[model samples]
Target chain A: MKQNIYDNPTFFNEYKKLRESGITYNDFIEQPAVKSAISCLEGKTVLDLGCGTGEFVRYCLENKASYVLGVDISKKMIEQAKIKTENGKADFICAPIEDINITDQKFDVIISSLAIHYIEDYDGLINKVRNLLNYDGVFIFSTEHPIVTARKEMDNWIKDGEGNKLYWALDDYHEEGKREQHWYIEGVIKYHRTISTLVNTLITNGFKIEEIQEPQSTSEGLNKMPKLVNEKRRPSFIVIKAQKSCVT
Target chain B: MKQNIYDNPTFFNEYKKLRESGITYNDFIEQPAVKSAISCLEGKTVLDLGCGTGEFVRYCLENKASYVLGVDISKKMIEQAKIKTENGKADFICAPIEDINITDQKFDVIISSLAIHYIEDYDGLINKVRNLLNYDGVFIFSTEHPIVTARKEMDNWIKDGEGNKLYWALDDYHEEGKREQHWYIEGVIKYHRTISTLVNTLITNGFKIEEIQEPQSTSEGLNKMPKLVNEKRRPSFIVIKAQKSCVT
Candidate 1:
């Protein structure tokens, strides 16, 4: 099931399998991404676009947020949320990110994590997130580093023993929205947007690049051995925290 | 650094790198496991214990859950969640799973997706989950598949070719609370529980095993590839949904 994760139960199921086996999402989501998003959340009303399972929603509530709204397209996920939460504290809605209606209520903060990559249209998604926020509201999000999407050939995307980390050539990455379909899943879609494309889209959507967070890898314990073997390596993830232009 | 996710800028920064670079939590938490978890969540009060980033919380919420409580140890994660959701609609708490004062609340559904592996004591973890649920409350969760964990030889983990796709050798399928430090992030802890450990834990905790979903690769739409190309592969993940015993 190589199809895009949304359409393919098999592909998504495989991922679920991996999680159950042993790996914890915290190991991957880590601290840097969560912390950066929290820094911008202080005393602000927030709209968590693509709020999968309300992780960030819970985060904001405990941090003294005045208001919050979490929305997602997955109805099954929302049902789970309803049972686990008290409605007086946090609200969750089921709606596609693309078709969300941003009514009169305005939010000071809007954040998404690793969820935007699944969207087929980049510009439309950014514009939608922009519409949901109040004037000068901050929008901070973290996306799958473009490098992985730009280059799908697994072999071309690994570290070698040449005393340095390796990356795939540019050609493998330039292909846009490669089609990976499966019987058990619908078409798997990924739009590989470079940092430049990402920046330009925000600007087009009236967002100013207030901050750019590039979380690099650290060599403390187990990583020291790998780093000692190959010191020159680039990190795999990036966190971008931007603000809705107060200028307008 | 562990006190709050926001305090640790590295968590966000490094996580961004991994996401951008193409390493995803999806790789570990697959779709099949999620669907299996969803199957059990119909009209149930779910507690997503150790719910990081609340993906499963959203899943339960969307599935028409009667109620949900998204809990995690990371205060910063809880704060981001507050920022993302409406207050009092769904609830979120910042507390360790062990310290959770869950006496009055008995969930119909208690779930921990890719979270429990962090608890080093498997028996204690299961007993704790059992204590939190009501009679017939389904405790459904997923973890990294045992085959994948047994294949921690590193080099042999990522194999390709052969009739079996992504074949992981089935070796030690029952190890309880095997502890290990995370590879990418420092100061994080993880535990590996085998099938026997998981099943026995459920039985010992007075929960009847309801379903064990084993997913195999299917070439539903391979252009010219034979369906036999993927078969009898070692499980990369496991989704176990068990119900609390009403009798006894």
Candidate 2:
């Protein structure tokens, strides 16, 4: 049997319902990752791949972009996105990432948020995301830092000399399209990638890295004092903003 | 007790040791923050207040800066900083933060690192740093995000959804300029300022806010899976790169 995202789709449905009912969970696009992505997006015709809930799409719309297409696989997410963006600032589409065919129309900015990790076909997803971009158009998205994934054993955390604790878990994990089956809290399917593999796949698929941001904690990390734990040890998430290279 | 900072000063000595040993701690400046700051430092005389080891001073020198001066309260740190750049790319001063009066030579860029928290007289420190800047010059620095201090509790930690497994614990007390506060650990001193406080301090001191970046994690945050308990919860740290307004 295909794994249930939760024992029932009702959970995600409920989650989406909750979000739609004036309750917003995490809008990954509103986070700093997407903010960094906006630098390359101004004045570009953008395609938001896996544009769940349309937060980023709206950002693109508000930033005076030529136009924006918010695409997602979840119909409910699309409906909620359409409802939330009642101003009709941008367009929304309900389609799997694999089915996003932008052969005719190209975009100057293409992006995704925390949504791409759910897709198992890594290269396919990247190539599809790449195909939607115009020359030098950039792709920016964020994911769980690979180090956190590599050192994911719950016991990897330890205290430092200052008696302040730290998690030195996986520093980076990347292998070409390696698959790890995940059973979400409700038994939903999830997939993960490492930094190297993800970047390599993008390079192979014709994208050049313009910038990558490793976000520390919000107001929280500083108080937590992760800086002294290990100097090079950063947080567990990275926001990557890459350009579709004309050279490539 | 005049606060013997240079006399048998342990934190100063530690900073000197770290610098003299040619150690590169992540504390002084972040790479992206450095790049962003340097972008604004071109052809300018840069002053690094609280210049821990003077790494950013060196960066300014290597970049398009006309001149660079690094000031620190620690004698040993200044000594090491001088030794590190004997080629005279920059100059260093070993003086207390408040005592360094520079009315003659104005700087185009003034910066600080994770060092300003050691200052108890936040207003005085801000004034001194501000006074050092030339008209329309900038004062850019990175500090511990204030939200980290105000919102987080010592018991707030990362855990699995079940809350049974402890992922990480936060236990650090830095009472901003009070040496040897009784935390669970021993540390020098630190002050906590929220984002608004930081902005207000800069504005009140005749500076203006240019940009603020709450860093995400490294490549790890983006590529990996098995998110940290705090990944979605808090920012790790904040990088505030501000400027001295020409009008003000």
Best model per DockQ: 2
Over 4 Å off, model 1: A1-31, A40-42, A152-155, A158-169, A172-175, A179-187, A217-232, B1-248
**Residue-wise C-alpha lDDT for candidate 1, range A1-248, written one tens digit per residue:** 21124323565466445534533333343334546555645577978776755666777887778788887776655665566555675788888766778687878887776667767787998887877878878788776655445444322334468743333222233245653433234445555665446665776577755445434333342243333212112234556666676543
lDDT of each: 0.59, 0.59
Q: Write the per-residue lDDT of candidate 1 for residues B1-248, one digit (tens) a residue.
A: 22333236677566536534532434333444456455556677888877655656776777778778999887766776667655544689988776678778888888776666666667777888888888867887777654345322322233457533332222222233454444545554455654446665676578765555444433332223344223222344567777777643
The sequence of per-residue lDDT tens digits that candidate 2 reaches over residues A88-189 is 548887777667776678887777776666667878888877777777778888765544444333234466899755533322132223334433243244
In model 1, how well does chain A match by TM-score? 0.76
Off by over 4 Å in 2: A1-17, A20-69, A75-91, A97-248, B1-19, B22-44, B52-66, B75-113, B119-167, B170-187, B192-248
Each prediction's Cα RMSD? 24.8, 11.3
How is the predicted docking of candidate 2 categorized under the CAPRI scheme? incorrect
Q: Interface RMSD for every prediction, one decimal?
A: 22.6, 13.4
The CAPRI classification for model 1 reads as incorrect
TM-score of 1: 0.43
